[model samples]
Target chain A: MILEGKKRLWAEYQKEIPDDNYFYVRSCIRQNFFPASEPTFLRILRDELKKDIFETPFHTTCSGIGYHSDIVPMETTMTVVARQFALMTEAGYENYAASCITSFGLYSEIIETWKHFPEVLAKVRKHLKQATGREFEIPQSLVHASDIVFKLRNEIAAKAKFKLVNKHTGKPLKVVEHIGCHYSKMFPSKGVGGAEYPYVLVGMIEVWGGEVVDYPERRHCCGYGFRHYLVKANRGYSVANTKKKFDSMEPYKPDMIITNCPGCPYFLDRWQYVIAEMEGKTYGGDGQGIPALTYEEVAGLVLGYNPWDLGLQVHQIAVEPLLDKIGIGYDPEAKYKGPNGEDLGKPEMPMSIRCC
Target chain B: MGKLYDMLVEDVRFQEGMKSCMNCGTCTAICPAAEFYRYDPRQVIDTVQTKDEEAIEDLLKSETIWYCGECMSCVTRCPRKNAVGLVIVALRSLSQKLGYFVESEKGRQQLALKRTIGAWILEHGYCVYPRKITVENHPEAGTIWKWEQDNLDLIHKRLGSNLDGEGNGGLRRIPQESLDELQRIFDVTGGSDFYNQIEEASKKKAEEMGLSLDEYVKFVYTTNNGLHGRDEE
Candidate 1:
């Protein structure tokens, strides 16, 4: 997040990198939709971690992109996406990671679909054999980025360097973690330590020394439409969905909010502003936006990372007050202002929980 | 306005929708989709009545689209007896028809579902079914693929839909006959093409995604996408 968005996390500082083989597979949606986080994560990985990870531009967005939209036709999505992953494994990178939880789930589905439908397997295999002239194999392991964050929280805390002070409010933030649905819904057993009580992002917040608040609907979504809400005419539903989290989080009054999946951040942060307007709150963000956060951005900020470095400045709802409260201060002078000299509001990029 | 307008419109047999909702928020409270999707079925009902298209558009950009598990938990629980689950499908249908379906990462996830579901329907003549007797039971079949099959009979038995010759005019159905009837219904309902395309595209998707179609197809329970596969980079 410090660099941009969920490209790669904890890679920038990693010195002893895995050399054998790793999957560079990412969701096209993440790369293109949520590029800001991607650059930051990649920086941490390549510049800091010193690991060898690669990408194939040919990789298409996991049809997971359209899975919720009820378009793209499921048959095409499964076969093509499965073949793509098989190509990666065959090329020697068996392990895969996705910035988007749904992408990870979709990847999991591809495998499950194969086992359930020999026709799908046969078709994918036949096509691959004919086109690539090589056989494909589904790797034994694939996981979400948050899964690793929680797994390596202890190690990450030990390497911490900077301490964050709020830029304006001057408060030390104690955050709560919000994990996306896909991460826990797809492969409950292998992905998160606790699908019932996933501790990936929440545990990492704890590792970062941030207090994790428990809200009533803490596990709820950011109200992102699998399809754009407008086209589907589900605005009120979308807004209400977004409001549930804010309404839940507002009571706790934590210094800040944190999450792993990019999509989760959109609602956690952006939706607040919208809800503020609907609920008629005066303290709504500059644009009346909501909280904007990602696990990497949250982790990077508390560990002495800057907002600009963490890409916090791009948020529609200003985090200036948030930083002040959390003890992670961005210089007040650079307070992100919107077009009217108010807060810049949130960035207008399509954010997601997937990696490109 | 899109090809999908007529594609699956005739097939959407949902009698209850959010329009009938009275804003009880009860559906929102218990909705699994609302839990993750942030979509309040109550709100969906309100928006439809208000015709708040712009706000609805904003909702489309959210992750809620993927939040609905289509569990229908809100159907009867709703005071208005509305099922926003079906409305979500309607929203998805609209999103798909408009190129706007590609707005968020969740939208992108939809691209693969058609094929996955299509192949399932083509082979088994159903999209998804009851959850029991999945791959979890057969270790050799790989746990993830074990969840693909849905046991309607088991579910019917559980739901008491089984009219065993004595109950409600003996609504019992012969296996093949029922399937043929379903096919006929689907054809009139515009579901046949929807199903056909799912299989067609799933074949290609499996290959591209490196999924083991062979293992998944033969596996007893296969619809679940493995969960918790997030990346850090």
Candidate 2:
């Protein structure tokens, strides 16, 4: 609980995330869960910031979920990841940026494993060669996409059309930022600020004019324990764990929650409705649940991107209220419209939680 | 050391995660699973460190090994720098490989994972595809999910996702060549064999429990042991 001690630890855990010219890999679930996030990230880096980030069609899933679920062997995950690195090498990029925290953690684990056991690395190399006839060198930089965002927060803040502060009250929004456990828990030094108090999201929140809330259970997992949520029966544990976090953060009365991980935002957003339905409890003021947003969505909003275009409408917990608080304007009719502006129809309202 | 302990050490995860356990209970104190389930990382590591073959076998067959969520929170706090979560990973792999995973309810969920995410990886090159997450399987995904599932292509297109299309973007169709290479990697490594082991073990258990394979899949997918709410502590 010592402030200076934590500051010292955070200082010690600062990572050297690369500035530009990186090879990116997409998440298996992030695309489906929060479809706009990866695109927003690319748009922010490529269009807005004018950085060089290349993505290849050849790269596939890193298979972290299967590995964590214990269904896929570590050797499979290692070889699959080696194939991804091979793709990056073929594309002539040395810095690797992963969109999913699980993939980031798995990549870090594999690299560390190879460092410890050269025989295993050699075996993975042999398998990759036999499978795809490809060879790869280790990426010079292995970073989560959020780390890139954190590294370039000031650049983003300079281009902002709005801030994380509420214009109505002239107060910084009380933002609860949740770092994915795998982002830093596996290797503290690999993340922007370390596990207990990861600064990847915090740096962005602070730089964009928001007050970070340090709730007691701020370090708790969002409960997307791969096997826990993947299996229908064991999902109680997942929701129960998420419910524990919501209960702890509720007293803080934050305006919104921001997460860097794919599952963190998905589960945090959806589990609010589940908790509301199960216990008739809501976290946000009035009968609504708190909005759980990905860091990219928040960035896109501050950078003046259209809310619907950022896919805020797809969120289970309506983000319109948070939008109103931030003084961002949006047409309610456009929430469910398609790309060419066709009406996509409205989602049915839930009994316990309010929806737009 | 017993035979089970010997086999456990063979996994690199075990070798890296298990160090000298002083039983400081820091890992148990911070373990979220221990708070809800009748599980303790301290005790689990102690049991493993005992190197008792019978105890290790019992650990594998029981629900204890399956309770860990593998969040790796324990790795952060352990004074001895142990990773009980990774140790659990090693244990679970050994459990599934040895056919002991079918003995417990939570462990039996491996077949469910294999069929869902595992199969999805090989089929679509993603763990959780948009089409695969249906209302029937994931009810808690809420009403918005139903709407999203109903308008999958339109919504993804609006969000600028390449969803089933080729090239780089959200949910884009992984190229057939890439998928073929992935399958080859799985075949070259032990992934296909591991999947087969899960399927065969679950099938044998299903027959022994007087259920068909499909019925067993449904049972494992939906059956709640009510362990979450039990006042086991």
Candidate 3:
């Protein structure tokens, strides 16, 4: 049966890409780190693709991080997820789209748990009904936003004003795609192309005209283990895990890194800054860290969105080097300006603190 | 008395994770946490297999269970299909259920986590609402967040968000009824009990240390925030 499941994971069980309408739930980490990415995704869907996406504040955190960290109990996690499903049921949507891979995995796990243990599902239903007088019909399809992006890769590429090729070199940019751990590792059968060699992000990179750099640590976790990154003493483990990826990917000298997972982009970007500080070595050409972007942000860039408006300027390591390579225009002085385009003035920095 | 070790062995996660153990070190070989810390998934499973009460208690009380990233790297590589990651989850759960979590540095941060992420779920529906992430505490959130804090309405408007307003597509303010419903679910599911357990234990620890409850919580939050295992010279 395990062999059969593994075979189906490779052949038959990958989630079919949804079309048209979706009920979107945001991720906690993604919104905080890459707030613009979600809004950008909505804009691309609504304006560019004409898809109907309903986002509500009533949909709460999936509590995947807390649950996995052992801070929140499994029962509590499932109950909270039931509340989210209840919200979606109340809103009259059957297709659920998650903005975070962890949430995606959590939802998938809960649904799978319900399939195997109906008693657990019954208890959740009883608790949810007692609490909110609400009940949910399981969503017809549950997908990560990256899955939607993967499904629409060619359409996005067709709409692109800029390709993933370097304007100076006239060559396709060497991009390393990092899939979040939960995206496939937790539920191997659920991911597009299964856990190993998942094509969800690769589909986007290839369709957008970028070379996907295959590395030794291509399947490694970003080490954003909610508690691993949260507790201060354990961050060395987080940094060490990232350092492993950098060491493996550094020799390839990839121009940019792209991620579908909300946590991966932040850690992959921020840890490079940390890695440079700790090891006195940088990953890419020159002493600068390689540019890392979420797949949604990458799509927004290709579709001719302004970098500042997409909040690309706020990244810890500068993205201008990649912007220059992509031939995307942005006035560096106006990077941190207010919405009305007022200059915030150059930020005061300590002797060694540099941000681009 | 039913031994705590037996209860751990009977946990659903432990049952689901462990099929048969061959004492293979494949899980440890692939673990990110094992490289940096004293964590070894193989050792954790092997220790549990011994079924010694004191050994299990020590496992619960020690920082080893807290070290697994829960990445499931062990799950993918285990030849015997034993999910060492799930074993860690069960041990951590047993530790928390028995209140042994308060013994370790990482374990004590449960209160901070409950207060922040746990509280956020009930209040805002989202674990992280943009307005709550301050530049002072999270400097890595960077200048863009600082700018967003100042010009939220304008930026959100441009980006097509309602900025927590009602009847808008982007992060609409959750209705009060929904928030109440969520609270009730938490109440029913023992979330409140879990939180109270952390508070009750921490309060006792605080009283022993001669600090007020509020003062102790603040101390733990800030102290644990910076306690990422760096040596203080």
Please tell me how candidate 1 rates in CAPRI terms.
incorrect
**How much of the true contact map at the interface does candidate 1 reproduce, as a fraction?**
0.05
Cα lDDT tens digits for candidate 2, A217-327: 999999988888899888888998999999999999999999989889999999999999998999999899899999999999999999988989889998988999889
| TM-score per candidate, chains pooled | 0.56, 0.98, 0.91
lDDT (Cα) of model 3: 0.79
Candidate 1 lDDT over residue span A213-237, tens digit each: 7878776656655533312223344
Candidate 3 local lDDT, A1-356, one digit each (tens): 69987776567446687886899988777766676888899889999999998876666678787787676777888888987887788888989999999889889878987897788899988988887788888899899999999988888999999999999989999999998888887677788977766999888999898999999999888878787776554566777788899899988989999998888988888787766665667776656778889988899999999997786865666788899999999987777666667655544331222454
Deviation of model 1 at A304, angstroms: 2.9
Off by over 4 Å in 2: A1-11, B228-233
Off by over 4 Å in 1: A1-21, A32-34, A128-134, A163-172, A228-232, A282-290, A326-356, B1-29, B32-233
- Candidate 2, residue A72: how far the Cα is off, in Å: 0.2
**Residue by residue across B1-233, what tens digits does model 1's lDDT show?**
33333332332322325446667788788775554443566776576555455656655555555557543446535666565766676666655444444454454344344444333333332232223223333222111122112222322232223222221211232244334433343343334565444344444545655666554333212232323112211
lDDT of 3 by residue, B32-76 (tens): 877766677799988888888888899898877887888887877
Residue-level lDDT for A266 in candidate 2: 91
Q: Pick the candidate with the highest TM-score.
A: 2
For the predicted complex of model 3, DockQ is 0.48
- Among all windows of 10 consecutive residues in model 2 chain B, the one with the lowest summed lDDT is B224-233
Q: List the candidates ranked by TM-score, beginning with the highest.
A: 2, 3, 1
